[model samples]
Target: MSTQSQPSQSVLTEEESWELLAGQKIGRLATSVAGEPEIFPVSFEVSGERIFLRTKPGTKLAEVTISPRVAFEADEIGDDAAWSVVVKGRAQVLEREEDLAEARGTGLVSYLEDGKTVWIRITPSDVSGRRLVPGDQR
Candidate 1:
């Protein structure tokens, strides 16, 4: 007879979640406009407890302005393991000069060719993550 352990899932700590989030440059931003939900792929940077991303005048910006509450998610998957992080909080456009300067200092560049001139900051009220380790199936 042989004994085997099944795959397991674990909840990540807040620090672990932040570490994972900081390592990834791409994430999905979920926003709602009059109860209509939309998600957008964005390139972002983590600074302290805040997340920053650049965007142009578009639906994403418009939605954020309309509904400041949003959600951001990032994840990594591999053959052996996978992890995901979710951040729920309020987002705002960087309007103050000091804030704009700080955001510019993050060196965050948009994947788009041009027009990503607006900086939005996400201040997370809740952050959570999960990690999954796969077991042998064969």
Candidate 2:
């Protein structure tokens, strides 16, 4: 019996990559607080060009609000398949109470151990993604 090697895709198209991010539910939000880089896995919902991550009031919250600039990323890896996307831009905490309540209702749990009652918005300046399939090699 002969078996064919699974085909691999090394690079994902911009549309394909964005679609993956949009359809996904969970991702990691990376930021710096107290001069230390921090990464927190978060449940997200994407709308248009903006990515929304909900987290409760915490140190990260204060960091994002104060810093406003950050990086957010997401990735999926398989035995032979790996993909990652990164977002570089400014992040801002929701100011309106109504928006906060609505975002919290979506059920996004953060590393802080509780869902975000206030949503953090990341307006990506640059967004890119790559995929490593079985065949194309790295």
Candidate 3:
């Protein structure tokens, strides 16, 4: 299915959905490794047109450090309902300390777990979201 959300009464407006997604501090980032989609839950924030994530030295850091293209997602769910937003983008490490600080500041506390804090940023080429409600099941 297309990533973009189909318009409906149960669905939130694109702007509303994006705003919700962007405000959240965590999501699943999907990337390809050896032809398989690798997805991981991560803490992140929307900074301008880019989404910034912080990771320690690990697969997440290693994967994007090698390949820049990546996908990001953030969603919120409730009883019998949910909304999700997807972002197709290019990923990179935030090199500057100022940018890193600003990106980290976006969330309550730090976005990273206790460890060596490494910054990863994704510049989105496409943004999409969808919402599911009770009537959609019919």
The alpha-carbon RMSD values of the candidates against the true structure, listed in the order shown, are 1.6, 4.5, 6.0
Please tell me which model should have the higher TM-score, number 2 or number 3. Answer: 3
- Candidate 2 per-residue lDDT over residues 14-105, each given as its tens digit: 67767888867778878886688888777787766678887777877877887787888888878877888888899878879876665666
lDDT of 1 by residue, 1-138 (tens): 545568899999999999999899999999999889999999999998799999999899999999999999999999999999999999999999999988988888777747788899999999999999987766
Evaluate model 2: give its lDDT: 0.76
Model 3 poorest 10 in a row by lDDT: 2-11
Report the C-alpha lDDT of model 3 over 1-138, residue by residue, as the tens digit. Answer: 555554343556657766887678778999887777789888776766677777888888888877778988888777767788888989988888887787777663455557857778788888877877644432
Off by over 4 Å in 2: 1-9, 97-115, 136-138
Q: Which ranges of candidate 1 are over 4 A from the true structure?
A: 1-5
Highest TM-score model number: 1
RMSD of 3: 6.0
Error of 1 at 33 (Å): 1.1
What lDDT does the true structure give each of the candidates?
0.94, 0.76, 0.76
Least accurate stretch of 10 residues (summed lDDT) in model 1?
106-115
Error of 2 at 30 (Å): 0.7
